[model samples]
Target: MSDPILRLSGVFTDIAQYHILQGVDFEVPRGQVTMLLGRNGVGKTTTLRTIMGHWRARAGQIVLDGQDIAGLPTPAISRMGVGYVPENMGIFSDLTIEENMILAASSGPIDRARLDWLFSVFPPLQTFWKGQAGNLSGGQKQMLSIARAMVEERRLYLIDEPTKGLAPAIVSTMAGALRQLKDQGASILLVEQNFSVARALGDSAVVMDDGRVVWAGAMAELANDASLQERLMGLSMEAGH
Candidate 1:
């Protein structure tokens, strides 16, 4: 809505001969959590990948903090302060938890205060400080992935399905940790299927269908209208929430 940290305009991507993003467009407002919602196979993961430079956009502009980064290399984008946590929970399985966090802090050594705050939010990192990342449970690994992104400060965070396939209790934890990020003035573009989590954390909502933004408005407007949800997402849900 204001001071958008990231903007994607007319973005198109093709993997081999198959088209993925067909003129995708959206903006992530600064200091707010924008939920990227859509049914499966609508190019949500591909959109994130394109933004992070894992998949280059064939056309259009991806403006990050007033600079176009659509075709830049992944490391260049990372250096420009865009953090990504893919759906796969991108962590080195054989590395210790400490090692994973260290690798995530590419700018420099992680500050002690930031690490303390991460430990406060994700206590398991402290509990398994010496354990390999592969040894942790699925939910714990998810926590590790998010905590690694929070290891150092960044201008924007692109997170994909942080709460996927987790228990209700763990989902609550994940949402709370995200709330902490929002509270600290971080801008996040989150892809979440769990209506509960999306409703709880989103300030604005963007609904993508067939790789294009079909709906963009306040999160409350989208949350209160079940018919719109059904039309855009192909299912009605959580009427009054």
Candidate 2:
């Protein structure tokens, strides 16, 4: 197997007085999606934040492309070619979709070719290009958030619950966009509550509980065994059947 683009070894994170993310370890392989799965409050979101440097890891290492990034600031981490989409869909409400795209183009001006590709994947972005982002529907806003992250080329994407609160049809669209991203050779570490989305997109799976990794294996193995799925994630893939 290829080396992981991102790896966390014994990572610990703290939020104010609360201690979250205790010794988490996982690997996101190059050019594939790794599903980070668990129930609510299992430190899934915290782990993503810690990787992005929004929350500091008090102990352990966050290695990206063979370099330790645990001590780096958020901007430095981002500059290292990591794109993050927080669970809150971090788009500027007052800005136009075009402006948001421009702001996210940290490397330089938005490439017209890349912009056209993104619009093809998400046609709503083109339809609402001149409109204020706040006026977009929830699904369109989610598309914009993911699109913002795509304005520039990045080695890895850390996405938190892209399917959260989205309608079934919209979730289907988001899943297709993610697959297209993978096909274009992007590595992704995804946190998703919806088992169907996770099962469909993940090449590997990591299960976390109480801030620690509890299971790691192939997505197919996890999906094939309902008992194992229940033990690790408290649900079966049967819902997707």
Candidate 3:
């Protein structure tokens, strides 16, 4: 059975005076990736922020493994084992790469085997471990952001636009690393603008428009249906652009 690791029911979130998410609902099944897709400004990032407790839900349920965590503090939610990589690649520019990783190991020490695997997937983290994070290139910053999330094993990962603005080769490398993460049974909820990456990794998908789930189905089904893709994605599928 495909049990949900996380579920949101009729979630409504506000940003200042503006309401960003109106009754957003979805489930991230255990041990699989669920792509959250839509054109720009469709509440995708807001949904993620709400889940991570960076933004408060105005109404409805944000359930994690059957626990209602709608109004919990961000640190409390994080302690419950939800890892997040924000759209801006939330890394401390002033900190060294090593210091960032050290902080991400919130539960305990970073596992040596996991650190080795992360270095293999993202060599720059090893290459520039002691360097200031602000000195890294865009792609390297993204790699460090993701590696920071994997410094500890978590119940679920909420990753936003991880492959955005990266070289094709680097995108491929990132996809490969995520593939390995999936193979190891990590559950991921990814918000990706790259259609090819979304199609490649998402087991199931949820498409949002105007702050609500407009479509939800298997990723392969969406990928094969050109007209459906046209109707749902429009010209938004930027291959890897």
* Residue 49 local lDDT, model 2: 92
lDDT (Cα atoms) of all candidates against the true structure: 0.92, 0.92, 0.92
Pairs of residues at least 3 apart in sequence or in different chains that clash in candidate 3 = none
How close is each model in CA RMSD to the real structure? Answer: 1.4, 1.1, 1.4
* Residue lDDT tens for model 3, 43-89: 99999999999999999999999999999999999999999999899
TM-score of each predicted structure versus truth: 0.97, 0.98, 0.96
In every candidate, how many clashes are there?
0, 0, 0
Q: Number of clashes in model 2?
A: 0
- Model 1 bad stretches (over 4 Å): 239-241
Q: In candidate 1, what are the lDDT values of residues 40-73, reduced to their tens digit?
A: 9999999999999999999999999999998999
Candidate 3 residue runs with Cα over 4 Å from true position: 236-241
Q: Which residue pairs does candidate 2 place in steric collision?
A: none
Steric clash pairs (candidate 1): none
